[model samples]
Target: MEDALWAQLQNTGLEEHDDKDRIEAESDDEEVDVQEELSVPHEERLQGPQTGPKGVKADHEYHQQKKLVTESKARAEYNARLLAKAPMTTTYLQDEANKDREELLILQAEEEEEDDLKYYREKRLRELKNMSRQQRVFGTLTTITADEYADEIDEEMGDIPVLVHLFDESIPTCKLLDEHLRGLSNKYSLAKFIRVSALQLEFDLVESPAILVYKNGILIANLVRIIDEVSTRFDIDEIEDVLTRHGALSENDLYDLPTNYA
Candidate 1:
């Protein structure tokens, strides 16, 4: 009976050991399951592209990002290639100098164009005034024989310059001067021209051909028949110049001649 009791006690001990082993095995399985639930997946831990806040990778935004990156790279390459042609100096002054030079050339060109336009405008105005002066015409010469015509000469005095030739018809120089005076009368019709024989005036001729210039009712000059300031046979331009210088013709008369007529 003692043997039977010892055998029963051994059996009970074996059963308790078996139960403890089963419980430890089940606890190990539960610990493995808890570890799996707490840890993250390998894909979720990777440093991938930023999706939206809800973790969605949109197709349109991904394509747009790729296009922007490609365009940025292309622009950077193009700028680098262009800048290689003209490299910057240590101070970057060489690039700035070229830019300033280009700007100066553009400004100088604009100023030259403006100056040329102004010169043309002034030239055209002068040309028009000269044309008008040449188109004007004056009247005929008056031959005075008696003092009765002096009143008529006095009336016309101050308005125009009066050029008078006192002549002795017997002198050959006087006859030549009379013809030249008549020609001048037709040209300067604005001025009054007169011829008076000294014999008709009952005066003695100190000189055969005497010219008197009068302006504004006063005598300006008395002269002999001379041209070219020295010789008798002279150019018409010289005659015109002489008349203009002496106040018979105005300053505007000089501009009426062509440039080459001098």
Candidate 2:
């Protein structure tokens, strides 16, 4: 019985070894199938040598270097164009801006000057117009004439000329000269000339029997006593001779003085 049991044990061990061998062979086949399934074709996969951490880092750095070189070239071209355009663009814009400023200032100054001139001219014209309107004509000298002179004279004498009587007709020598005075008055007419009676005009004055010369309602001078009286008298004949010398007197012979001195 002992010998039979020992043989049976040996047979059992042999069976276990065979089963182990079969399991190992099946596992090897399955590993081969999995590797084949996971792998791509030789043409499709990257065919290269085996790589490590250092090789991979080097490949990435090469791509980065190429990208940096391309970007730097593009940036340099753009900066060059920008720098070239700077001087012309800035100078043109600045000149245009300054011209506009100058034009505006000139227009403003001209407007102010025109306004000032207009204001001054208007002020001066207004003052002159007012002064011209508020002036008087007659003066204080109009109050001194006597009653007879008032009756003989008109109020509006206004720039008219007059003649005068020099000698008294009461004297015989003056009476002889009265004919010559009448002849002189006839010779120069339109001289709104007159003769004063010597007795009437000789009051309140040192020289008597004199011819009073008048123009524009003011007494100019008098013709005093003289020898030749008619042709050679140095009289102040303002209405005739003096005004003729100055070219201001007109003599139209239609209006004549009455010979009341005769």
Identify the candidate with maximal TM-score: 1
lDDT of 2: 0.52
User: Each candidate's TM vs. the true structure?
Assistant: 0.39, 0.29
In Å, residue 73's CA in model 1 sits off its true spot by: 62
Candidate 2 ranges with C-alpha deviation above 4 Å: 1-146, 151-159, 201-208, 226-262
lDDT per residue, candidate 2, 189-248, as tens digits?
A: 434444545555554323334555566556665556433243445344523454454333
Q: What is the C-alpha lDDT of each candidate?
A: 0.65, 0.52
The residue-by-residue lDDT of candidate 1 on 71-170, one tens digit each, is 9999999988878864543345866888899999999999999999878867775765564465432345568775844664576544567777778878
> What local lDDT score does residue 210 receive in model 2, on the 0 to 100 scale?
51
10 residues in a row with least lDDT, candidate 2: 135-144
Q: How many clashes does the backbone of model 1 have? A: 2
